[model samples]
Target: MNVGQPKHLSRFPAKTDLTHQEFWRGLPTLQAEAVLLGPGRLEYKMLQVTGRDLLIFRSKVAPKMASTIVPHPDWVVLMVPVDWHGDYVFNGQVARPFDVFVSGGPDGYSTTGEKRHNLALGVRKSSLKEACANLSGRYIEDVALDDQQIALGAAVGTRFHRRILETIAASLEKSLGSGKFALDAVVENDLFSEIANLIMAETIEQNSVSSINLDPVRVVRRAEELFEDRTTNPPSIADLCKAANVGTTKLHLCFNEVYGVSPIAYLQAKRITQARCTYLSAEKVPPSVKDAALSFGFTHSGRFAKRYRYFFGEYPSETLNKR
Candidate 1:
């Protein structure tokens, strides 16, 4: 096992003296401390940057008119609207609920009022680069994921991302580690990487939406159906065209326009994700990467490895070993 000490970032005890009115003044200070140094606080919880790519943040901000927050050198803020809605101006763009946007550079500000905020997970630039090396400094200033609006409560991807956010929050609250040990250190890093890659994949799609034109809703649905049926092997672009009843060219255009990556690339990523689950499960002695690649219609191991690493920031072997 890897040996390391738990990095002790600050931990705040629950404060009873904090009034709702005083929340505004304290919010920036908390965020600054966390983003700048380490963990910072708000209401009953805290925000912790676990590693290079993951951020575990849970805060309840009362209300405020306008507040400014600068970016940190290690992360780019991508807010996924959970329980509140407001105009967030980042790099001169106002992001609304159900809308995925990123603050350019390493800093930005947030403005909210009387919103019981749940969580805001920050995606690390390094983790993202590890996952999508081809992106190489691209989409650095934008949302970085698919564009089709997932209709506040219905989008599958949206729901998945939020679920991850909630899971991290829950995990942090139940953590037994004193923030300084070996086992805990490894667990924290693993969890952080998992969260980072999940968010990174989503943001990559979000930022690339302009290049894809297929209806976001439809693309999500079709992709889900395709992924659910493991037995059925279909060509990505053609299959999307067939599923959506659009011509090949239109399907390609729309899918690329809405998701940023070609439909096939997206499909490949989905397949790889499926394989990751299988490989990580204790009930199975997962297929070799080559066999998994073939099962997913990826015949070329080299190409599959490249794509798999791009989607998840690690090779299939590395991921399997983690299991």
Candidate 2:
């Protein structure tokens, strides 16, 4: 695959004569309701790749301004503030600069003191799940950050993190400008995978501080046992919580602390691993990807293929073909 310019791009130039409605319309992934507490201006831009969406925006609003964001179901939002001060309140927590917010849930609200500039990435859920699988051997659908925010602090300043961010920024800039390139599909997949992995890894590593006290060792072992026993049909989060004799919040914290992924994500990885093993072992006459997926409780072959590619960095067909 060759790397080339993206086939589609959208830009919304900065304008001082912008209404709240206009600013809301310019947002890429979410339908937001913005209330301007005082005078200010908003500028927005967006770039779309095959499977990912990038957004850059700057909002100058009053200290009391707030916005409610509702994200698309199939996408997860990653907010990285570029230049700004003040905090965003979401999920009953405050998010500040250098903190990345990853959410794919109910309506979220954010408020800033004054001016705010940030880059938000809208990634498909499958892509993020695959990234989590690659990084932690788990298929995490969503990561709940500490107080709904992952504080980068000195972590973002590190050479490694800076390099990854720079690379992503450069790619976006190139795609936004000349818009000419020959990027292979597989190569593009790998590039996005790497970017997601780097960002998630850094976020997980830096946000390791958990205020909740729980026996991570015990919780992990019990959860592992439950997943092992019910490999064919995994238990739900509620079931896991009930079996573990813990609430949902504690379960999440415990799993995150021990495995760097949620319980459900770990279960997903286990099932995918099982499916892969079955497919690989069917040597003489392999079952089709669809067959494997169905045998493992996946009804949608298209989504299965995407998740499989994200998790293993190759298509299910490719995996079977290797044999």
Candidate 3:
């Protein structure tokens, strides 16, 4: 478990800023929300990262009313509990406060509690993998060893690991300040180095573990190609699984392990990218955002709007009007 002074990220009131929904529709970014519940409901604080990989938010919650927050389809989250007790589920894994857990999805992780103190960080998948790749050789059949066991030591090795986690956490806090633009790259590098080092060292020590044997690399490559193809309908997950000749669970893990996001998230990201470009190109048409979302396969406009707000900040109308 990692611990430090809690830091508050800058919050943009999502409910008040209607145009913020449009901003998310136009970019690839990491976004986060910190909610402090009151009487019935109060405005949640939103932080949208335009050109960054890491985000951190600390919230003060009440002890009786639970909060359910859903993130966008482009984030993999890490939650550290500073206070309270609750069930934290990511994908299918359930975790307590002291245990560290990782999961990939476009939709992000979820937590419910009346009152809790927590630190939430969301990093982009591509950035995450690139960061992890810095420790290329230590990977056992492409699966990094860091995710295999809980790292808790007090030696030179443990101290070093602690330092790395601290650096990453500190860099995240820096993102909430004026030097954010510059600190983005720094944080990514530090995070990657730390993860790679830990994984590589553990891999060397744990040589007894079996190696991974799968075709996720191929599956991911084909999936990316399908995502890029806009002419006809691309292959579904099953089709791609067949095309790659891998099991569904293996394929899911591979894509997530390599890309830091699941297959579905990758597809949705592609659709959103296309929709943004289309929306930006047709300022003269004045089409509804719903129509624009539909053009790219986002059938649930309200959900799309919420995701848009998370990724960008303004609603689609604001994006159109700004053009």
Q: Write the per-residue lDDT of candidate 2 for residues 127-242, one digit (tens) a residue.
A: 55544434443325444322246676644424323432333333342353222112223223433444454455555432222436667778667767776776655554544554
Each prediction's RMSD to truth: 14.7, 12.9, 16.1
Measured against the true structure, the TM-scores of the candidates, in listed sequence, are: 0.39, 0.44, 0.38
lDDT of candidate 1? 0.46
Question: Lowest summed-lDDT stretch of 10 residues in model 1?
Answer: 1-10
lDDT of each: 0.46, 0.52, 0.46
Which of candidates 1 and 2 is the stronger one according to TM-score? 2
Model 3 C-alpha lDDT per residue in residues 196-269, reported as the tens digit of each score: 34434544332222236655677678656655553234334434444444434555677898889886676566
* Model 2 CA deviation exceeding 4 Å by range: 1-30, 42-64, 86-92, 139-147, 157-191, 194-323
Clash count in backbone of candidate 3 = 15
1 or 3, which is superior by TM-score? 1
Worst-scoring 10-residue span by lDDT in model 3: 9-18
Q: C-alpha displacement of 56 in model 3, angstroms? A: 2.6
What lDDT tens digits, residue by residue, belong to model 1 across residues 20-55?
344334222224321111133343333432433455
Best by lDDT: 2
Query: What root-mean-square deviation over C-alphas does model 1 reach?
Result: 14.7
Question: Alpha-carbon error at 86 in model 1, in Å?
Answer: 7.0
Which is better, 1 or 2, measured by lDDT?
2
